[model samples]
Target: LLSIVDKLSGDSGIGRTLRLAYDFRNAAAYLKYLWFSGEGEFKSFLPWGTLEPDALRGEIENILNEQSTDIEPALAGAVEQARHLKDAYKTPLAVDIALDRAYYRYAARNLPEGEYFSRWMAVMSDWANLKSFVRVINFGLNRKLFWETFAEGGDIPAGKFKEAIDLDTDSIPAVFIHTEYGSRLSDVIKTALGGEMSGLDLFFRAKLMELYRYTRYCIFGPELLWAYAMTKQEEINTLRVILRAKGAKLPFEMIREVISVVLE
Candidate 1:
């Protein structure tokens, strides 16, 4: 994988980022396996001579960081620019609009959640300055929906769970069926999906975010989120290909088939 990344880094034109990203993924998987097994002299294989695993995270971070000066600079610059662009919005509507723009306009959907959400929050901070309503609505919505996740055993803190869901039972008929969050993940998921019809919007995005978060932390114990990220990575490359084709005055119809709607 390291060799592939080196080769991809040296290559020019034609989906270079995609090739690099693909190789990076191979490294990520290998590092994940090593960390999970908690065995072997993994340090011997790492190119970073003196680095050691401070946590399970050391391997992948080292690869991306130590790899040529190019990777770190590009990643840092992209992060900085994303944060800068997000600061332009100054209202709830503006914040949402900025996110929407970043998603489709700048191919922001291709970024990892850490980078993507950081950008979102930076934009949101400006929007909050213009209108307190942004925080009120956003926090109220998040806190209310967070309890629903708590009540459904969504890996949220147990101590905060009960208080968060302390709302009128009479107003919420669905909560009555599942009095406490189930211990079993299967039960939690079933109740979350089959019960409750009031908070669909929050539920879906929350679920996606949770899946994305865990997949990053836990690797491919669940397949969907990893697939989603990779799918978006491919989309980023596809968009670049389209831009390049247009610049070179080539037909784009054939390239369109290469694009995928989802990572899988």
Candidate 2:
């Protein structure tokens, strides 16, 4: 995927955004590796953007060897923020939430505003925030943490999430009533609140697939490429689910239930 995105040339906005997204993922992974393993090696990491793989490896090694705080500033900053939150709250989830917020913020800053790709990313961010909200609420975690974890750049304002956190489960859908995702995802939100956690990803994937359908009419553009990439990812996810089910010797019906209907 990184190679394919890198090969695209001449005003490929989506490609550039994808490369940055990949970089964010790699950077986060590198930080997590250092935090857990107490060592840094980029042998298994994907390389893209302005950072060369060899240079990144060397920098990571230097940081590990000298116990230096010097690393890629963006990733280093995110890790530091997460570490601060973890120290204050003593929850590992703070690390994930901080990294995710940074990832979405990076994407939003890099992508052009008001474009389809940017809107799609906003929807993704909204879905992530919604998922985090559901988890925090359902698990009886601290509601105050939501404010810190909320990723900016979503179509749904952070204020809406703050308000929704106080509402009854039945009234939660009202928070999104005016947004583009409201109609499509309202039922999913209700279902998720009812304890169907898997529905969250299922609903988001379905909406994303539906969004990609419009790109089918375009003869040429990044939309088609984006759709293809999304479809391939869906396919990969489906295969992984099926493979896991088979390995576990799960019933066919059980496997079928976990399979996403959007791809079918």
Candidate 3:
């Protein structure tokens, strides 16, 4: 993935955004290293983006040495959010949410206006927020935490999300009635409310496949590459699930339920 991203023209937005995505992942891992008291093998980290290994080491050392203010804005923002959560809630889950919010924020900020990728990012954010809502309700977690974990720049307003929490399963669809995700997710929301966690993934993957199909009509541009990348990722995920199910000697029917369909 790193090599592919590197080979793309410097002007390519998709390539630039992909590198940022990996950098955000690496940044999260670096924060995890600090949270664990630097116990892990630092050499095992997959370094990418503008941060070289030596530079990343210096940044990490600076963070540990109380010079966090010098760190880059994107990473520093994520670390600061995690730090606040640690001081207050002291939960590892909060750190994950912080990094996720940072990543989406970075993507939304960097993506060009009037592009399909920007629209896709909005859809992605909505799906993420929806998943967070479902998890919070299903686990009986505090509703206030939803605002902290929510990623901005989605088509659905944050206020709508806040309002949706108070809604019953049947009423949740009304919150997104005019949006693209509404029809696709309505049945999935009902199933998820009934405690079937996998239903959400099923709905998300199906909707994503539908979106990817639309990208096929683009004759030239980043959308083609982006669609291909997303398809490959889904294929890889499906394979992993299949292999794991086979290793466990699960029946085909049971295995089929957990795997997503590949759109050709």
Candidate 4:
């Protein structure tokens, strides 16, 4: 996997940022795993390639203090910018938008290998935008603040996402009807209205997996590499979520909803 990341990330700092994103993910999962075991279901996914759960080092938040030197830097700049925006806006939403934009922008740039992979990045962006729009409506977020989260490189128009804020549930899906998510927007809206915001995220996640599953038969190419990476990340993410929810003792329905996505 490291070799694959290295091969794909050879384009500027984008590849390095990809590794850094994994570092953050693994570290976060390790910490949560520790919290669950009070020190240890998660043994397999806890790769510990970076986290060092037994070392008991300082908090992983320290990753935020990393310097972005030209010789070696990942998503540090993006992380720092997100931190700044978080402080300025007094909302975590800024951080979410900033990091996501950086990750996608870099991922899209790094994958010059195939247009299909590039389109994957674009669809992922659309999902992010669509999900953010759902959150804006559900949480009553500031109208102007939603624009800050708008990302480029997606089929969906920025204006369409902007117009969705004033829309009710019945009317929101129509805004995206002409775009990549036209057929799926209905379910996105239905799941959002079903009262579980997490479900909306899972809905898109399942779509990405569906999108990539067809490429597995490819004997060779960056597409296969991406498929494997996406599948692995899906495992890590799903397990991480289930473990956290279990550790927190959330309801079974919540876990079941997420598990269903993975099962599909």
What lDDT score goes with residue 212 in model 1? Answer: 47
Deviating ranges (above 4 Å) for candidate 3? 26-61, 68-72, 167-179
lDDT of 2 at 3: 56
C-alpha positional error of residue 77 in candidate 4 after TM-score superposition, expressed in Å: 2.7
How high is each candidate's TM-score? 0.21, 0.74, 0.78, 0.68
Local accuracy of candidate 1 as per-residue lDDT tens digits, 110-139: 324454333333433322221222222334
Q: Against the correct fold, how does model 3 do in TM-score?
A: 0.78
lDDT of 4: 0.62
Candidate 4, clashing residue pairs? 9-15
Candidate 4 local lDDT, 127-245, one digit each (tens): 77777677667666676656776778778888887676677777776666676666676666766855567756876788788867878676656676667677777787789888899
By lDDT rank, best first, the candidates go 3, 2, 4, 1
Clashing pairs in 1: 91-127, 231-263
Error of 1 at 255 (Å): 26
RMSD of each: 18.6, 4.3, 3.6, 6.4
Provide the lDDT at 44 for model 3: 50
